[model samples]
Target: MKKVLLAVFVAGGLAFSADGAAIFKSKGCASCHQPTADTVGPSLKKIAQAYAGKKADLIKFLKGQGKAIVDPAKEAIMRPQLTMTKNLPQEQLEALADYILKYK
Candidate 1:
């Protein structure tokens, strides 16, 4: 029973983490945001560094409650991306942030 429960927990973590990658792809974010290099928008590593120790703020930004910090000039370009994200449930947004944060 304990082994079964442990397996479930590990599986859950993997599943939740996978959502982050999926969200990035499905949201069309990769067009402008690369994992390690900047494209039209800032890179994920830059975003992670900018939001270091402030994951909650990052999540808030995704929710359309915070402002752009990494690429203010391209805020307009990134703004449209938020529309796709603003409606996502909180957990998914956190997962997205988690994936982005991993770049740091």
Candidate 2:
């Protein structure tokens, strides 16, 4: 049987990528977080840098299973947003993390 392709990219070989930027936009994340600016929330660059090589922890945070290491002061403000991310499937979470990490 031929494999069905959703979206494919070549990393080491063939790979799949979810549209994380689309996810961010559809989820209304851009309303608070910007690509490089600190608005109501921290910038994607800041988060990406803080979580560099720490994609697992970032996933945990997205799943509502970790603390805010980026900006503790804004934890309360960011908490509610976790509900939006916590229920995402593994693939989507990885995609989201990948998208954020691209800024690093």
Candidate 3:
């Protein structure tokens, strides 16, 4: 029974991570932020590096409760996009943060 519960927990975590990538793509995040290079927005690698060891803060930024730390000068360009993420459920927010942080 314990093993079954553990497996379920692990699987659910994986699902969230996968869902995060899907959500990122669906929301047009890939249009500006590349996996390793900056375009209109900072690269995922840059974000991950700036956000390293700060997952909660990343989630807060996604929720619009935190400020931009990656590219403060260009934050205006990304601020508008927060509307798409601000109301996401906490789990999704965490998953999204996890996905971004993984680039580190």
Stretches > 4 Å off in candidate 1: 1-18
Clashes of 3: 0
TM-score of each: 0.84, 0.83, 0.84
Scored against the true structure, residue 71 in model 2 reaches a CA lDDT of 96
lDDT per residue as tens, model 3, 14-65: 7865588988988899999999989999999999999999999999999988
Over the stretch 1-104, how does candidate 2's per-residue lDDT look in tens digits?
12333233244232334678878888899999898999999999999999999999999999999999999998999999999999998888998999898987
Candidate 3 residue pairs in backbone clash: none
Q: lDDT for model 3, on a 0 to 1 scale?
A: 0.91
Clashes of 2: 0
Residues 1-104, candidate 1: write the lDDT tens digits.
99999999999987865589988998789888888888788889999999999999999999888999988888887787789988888889888999899999
Query: Global lDDT of each model?
Result: 0.88, 0.87, 0.91
Q: Can you give the lDDT of residue 26 in candidate 1?
A: 82
